[model samples]
Target: MGVPLLAIVAWSGTGKTTLLQQVIPLLKARGIRTGLIKHTHHRMDIDTPGKDSYLLRKAGADQVIVASDQRWALMCETPDKPLGLTELTARMDHSALDLVLVEGFKDEPVAKIALWRRGVKGEVADLLDGYVIALASDKKLAIDYPLLDINHPLSVADFIENWLRTGQ
Candidate 1:
């Protein structure tokens, strides 16, 4: 089996994207090959008109791929709606990824690191297990899980590295 994945979920302004921007690069610096799968609650557009991939998809193709000397993009359009993490990962090649740092899907079976800014803590009733394995915050809260310094991405990145290298 491939290395297990974890989703990093938190409130909208809790710095999830900012933290990922910091952590992902550090993980790569440490030689960890990571794959990311982001779940958005809203519609998004990664394609623009006249782009080769866009044109192909407009021609009734279910999936369109465009690659160049630098990067590649794959757009899959369909009415098929998939369930949680298991179904999602099945669409990807797990062998190529050591860890999948998913950006959303709070209620998924995968482990999670909760993001909470010091003063912005939410009511604790709905945010426990299958929710937070750790906290990335500006100040320590009364939570039980390990506390992470969100400002220090290396530490967080190291935590992810260790979690993947071992079963912590």
Candidate 2:
């Protein structure tokens, strides 16, 4: 089995990352070891251009590992299509995490909490898809699932903690 996972999904500019920044610390205070996987559409690289790792990768090395006392990172070249959620999760160290929070991957068929803001573009559309177990919005709305206050990170963290304990 995989580590328990929950996704926080929303349109661009809806504060997915911002809310996570707040909620993660609260979860940590409760002793939840959370791992995260963020999906981006941009072509980006984390290594510096002239760094040895970057140079080696550019020289056609398929994978490279950089290590230090603080941390280590593996950079691998995936020339094919982007990996799906399961494939991506397999790369993570599941034993080290109590929960995995995903940002984006809005279309993936995983348990998710949909976030909404009143004025963001695409606000009119319904996000209550089959996989969305909860909705967090700035304003209240009638919905079958639990509705959380997007502005309050504590409540969000509470809901997550409860879910972790009971699988609700």
Candidate 3:
């Protein structure tokens, strides 16, 4: 009953991030309030060394919030246990969003649009599951689910807009 979540999933080297970069602006043009959560395997840190927030966090603060007139960010230390998608989603400020787009968590059981590119080592056939509502690819394939042209961001945005309207 909160912001509906949809994932754009693909194997590494696929255009999931690139596609989302284009699609997000298009979605905003259509008045959809969107939020995003991207997952990465590499170790990442947003806090900068010598910054007050960073220094405070390094001094055993479990969480640190840096605020300004323009924006704010919360950095939480959880090295002992990584949070899963559900927990992460719950932490977002849903009051300002209509939808949340997930970049990874491909194995999670969420409704998703799978992406595939020709010669990308993995087959589009293997990406399908009951949770997949659509497939975006560089080439067309015969499939039961909706097919999307990965090269065209407008078409992808159109599909998402329609999906939002229809609650699919």
RMSD of each: 2.1, 1.1, 1.0
Give the per-residue lDDT digits (tens) of candidate 3, residues 1-168. 878889999989998999999999999988998999999999899989898888889999999899999999988999999999999999999999989999989889988999999978787877888899999988879999889999999989999999999987
Q: What is candidate 2's lDDT per residue for 15-107, written digit by digit as tens? A: 999999999999999999999999999999999999999999999998899999999999888888667889889999988999999999888
Off by over 4 Å in 3: none
Score every model by TM-score.
0.87, 0.96, 0.96
Q: Residue by residue across 50-146, what tens digits does model 1's lDDT show? A: 9777887889998788888998877777568745677677777777777788998888877898777755657433555655677777876776788
Displacement of residue 39 (Cα, Å) in model 1 is 1.2
Give, for candidate 3, the lowest lDDT window spanning 10 residues: 119-128
What lDDT does candidate 3 reach at residue 12? 91
Best by lDDT: 3
Residue 88's lDDT within candidate 1 is 70
Q: Would you list the C-alpha lDDT of every candidate in the order shown?
A: 0.79, 0.91, 0.92
Q: How far does residue 75 in candidate 3 sit from its true spot (Å)?
A: 0.7
